[model samples]
Target chain A: MNKVWWKILGSVLVIYTAIAGLLLGVPRLPILNESIRNLYFHVPMWFAMIVLFSISVFYSVKSLSSKSEIDDIKAVESVNAGIIFGLLGLVTGAIWAKYTWGQFWSFDPKQNFAAISVLLYFAYLILRNAIDEEQKRAKISAIYNIFAFPMMVVLLFVLPRLKDSLHPGNGGNPGFNSYDLDSRMRMVFYPACLGWILIGYWVYTIRFRIRSIEVKQQAN
Target chain B: MKKILFSLLLTLATVQLFAQDNGVEMADKLRSDGKIYVVVLCIVIILFGLLAYLFSIDKRLKKIEKENFPKN
Candidate 1:
């Protein structure tokens, strides 16, 4: 697709997926019953959060090592987007929990880990704001951002794997793998994930552009 | 001040949550599927897209900067 066409396509896909996710994915799931449909929205938000956070880390590393102002902007914008997606993920997950787990906020290991990840990233933003010097802010935030990224990965992925739990997919609980998620569900779920993620990217790009403009205006 | 406020909010949340059931273990079990790798892959793809967009923005900004501040 041409550039304009690509942008149009992205926007269309986002709208289409959102409608499909709500209308179809949530209602038509068979395996794990209707509750499993939460994956369509909640899972994608988490995925977007991870993606944006990793980009923040990359920019952080680049900014610190090379002292590139552009890198710092990217790092900041990525973190902002990551925070937004993380909050969405948490909220949606909580709603899903209220229905399935019969509670809103649980101290489950994964949930705690998720919360810690959010707090750590939020602190990264605060650290950036606290520093006065541009270079120093970039350098310090970069280091912390890198550190936070891996910590989140371990908390959300590795640590949970090492334990058995009350969650559905953990502790040898029967999950999507063994569960009978049919082809119909997969159609809506995969696209929904992609569409939300693309929408996330659109937001990040817009924010990044705005930051870049601000930097240019400041320079002038 | 914001930090202090956040901490106080967090503390309140923790206390309130403690009064209720802590379903972390169960929630973990429910969400801890092998689909994590799929999540990782999706994350990587999104990152690449964002990175590419950032690079393009930087280039565009540099062009604008040169236009506005031509160092003659």
Candidate 2:
């Protein structure tokens, strides 16, 4: 976790994304136009969020077996970091929707499901705060987290596709891959996902460290 | 017969013109004027600034950890 190289690599990759994502050529779809560029900035946020939430679940499972406070801290801090990315995803998606889909908050299945999934994590945080006893809090919240993770996945990924969604790749609509995600866009999009995921992990580690420190300080 | 040939040529010329105008529009004007670079530079600067801040926080936390837990 303390390794510096990956953090530096992430920073460099993100900076590269900021420059290349804007300058690079993209598909010339009619409604999307230049806003197709949002693929680099917006889609990656959810990818990073999903990754961080996965890490949170892993730590939660560890906390359950080991009954360790440190593992609990890791779980909760990762959720906190993941929530930040999730919110960013929601806001960015809304802004993109406004211009392309003609509304900031279309009742699109994907958008609604995304919002609900983020709320699920919010409930996880609240669940933690509601409990006071340390061991009970860790154990119960870990169990809740394990359940929440799968629910989030289904809500965001599965339910949207099952219904009619204005968002791409849902319902009967073909995804960007079939139409707009040409090879040129992939060059920037893939790197953006990787870079943001790394940065999200970096943020999670920092939050974990700080929270662990606070726990230690409280003990002393 | 001559009139038919002339009208077919006219229609072909109009079709070519229509295709050119039908091309999808993008922010080509901004790119050509060189102002898109300004947006990119500003975003990069903000990204660097936030990253630097995060790094400093990480360093400070490391220092505090060492001081607080000397054995670990």
Candidate 3:
């Protein structure tokens, strides 16, 4: 009863956004046209991914300090959840780009940097698998997780801004707030981001619970 | 002075009706004929269906937990 409300809210907000996003009016801009509705669905995936990745890093730091296996389980599960959202963001962004930017993979700084950051996390996962022992795996991966997180921050946030790119808020491009997004869109957009982030957290918790059960079974 | 400010704000608000950008073509035909709801229906169904699938998995995990672990 206590934890269920937000999960229910996430589902409700997502459904509301899907309906309102399609039916509600949007700002008319060149190239985006009707596809501006992608703002509701596509943008939320990255917001959710970023939120989950931040959670993963926080738990990694906790596991390093506390030496708790549960913290390590949380860190790994959050990463797994984050990766799913990241891939969704990448594919949806590519599809949106193809319609608007002429090519699916046009070497846009945002796209390239995004792919690299995802690969960096994947490397973290592989690094964990290579170690057979639990304590060594947790500590070493926590170090790597902490180390890689700052570089990923640079890759996703700063590097893209330094180069010419088609992504909003990059190079000379205007952001949604500057043009496409208006007060009406904000009504849906903010809730959509909140909904997706909450859903990502929900998925992470479920995965954490399942992993904990497995660990307990193994112990017994 | 209060009346002047109120009138000015009202005028500013109404000016948006005459903004310069040309309006894009909305799917007026589909919306008018009510087919746009079909698209909305499909999207809602897909979103809810995925959520339902997740809930089922959660139930299965709960069952496993009950079977194997010490109940609190």
TM-score of each: 0.70, 0.88, 0.87
The alpha-carbon RMSD values of the candidates against the true structure, listed in the order shown, are 19.9, 10.3, 9.8
lDDT of 3 by residue, A1-220 (tens): 3267888898889889998888888988888888999999999998998898899999999999999999998888999999999999999999999999999899899999999999999999999999999999999999999988898889988999899999998888888889768998999999999989888988988888889888998898
lDDT of 1 by residue, A1-220 (tens): 1134444455555545544544453334433455675676688888888888888888888888789898999988988988999999888888877777777887766677788889998898899889999878888888888888999999887776667744656656656545545676677667766766666666677687677667777887
* Range of the 10 consecutive residues with the lowest summed lDDT in candidate 2 chain A: A208-217
* TM-score leaderboard ranking: 2, 3, 1
**In candidate 2, what are the lDDT values of residues A52-169, reduced to their tens digit?**
9999999999999999899999999999999999999999999999999999998899999999999999999999999999999999999999999999999988899999988888
Q: Tell me the deviation in Å of residue B56 in model 1.
A: 20
Per-candidate interface DockQ score: 0.02, 0.56, 0.46
| Model 3 chain A poorest 10 in a row by lDDT | A1-10
Candidate 2, superposed: residue stretches over 4 Å from native: B1-31
> Which pairs clash (backbone N, Cα, C closer than 3 Å) in model 3?
none
List, residue by residue over B31-68, the lDDT tens digit for candidate 1. Answer: 34444434544655664566467457646755765675
- The positional error of residue B17 in candidate 3, measured at the CA in angstroms, is 33
| Model 1 spans > 4 angstroms off | A22-32, B1-72
Tens digits of per-residue lDDT, candidate 3, B1-72, equal 999999999998767656523545565555663587879889999999998887788788778878876573
Sort the candidates on lDDT, descending order.
Answer: 2, 3, 1
Which candidate has the highest DockQ of all? Answer: 2
Choose 2 or 3, whichever is better by DockQ: 2
Off by over 4 Å in 3: B1-34
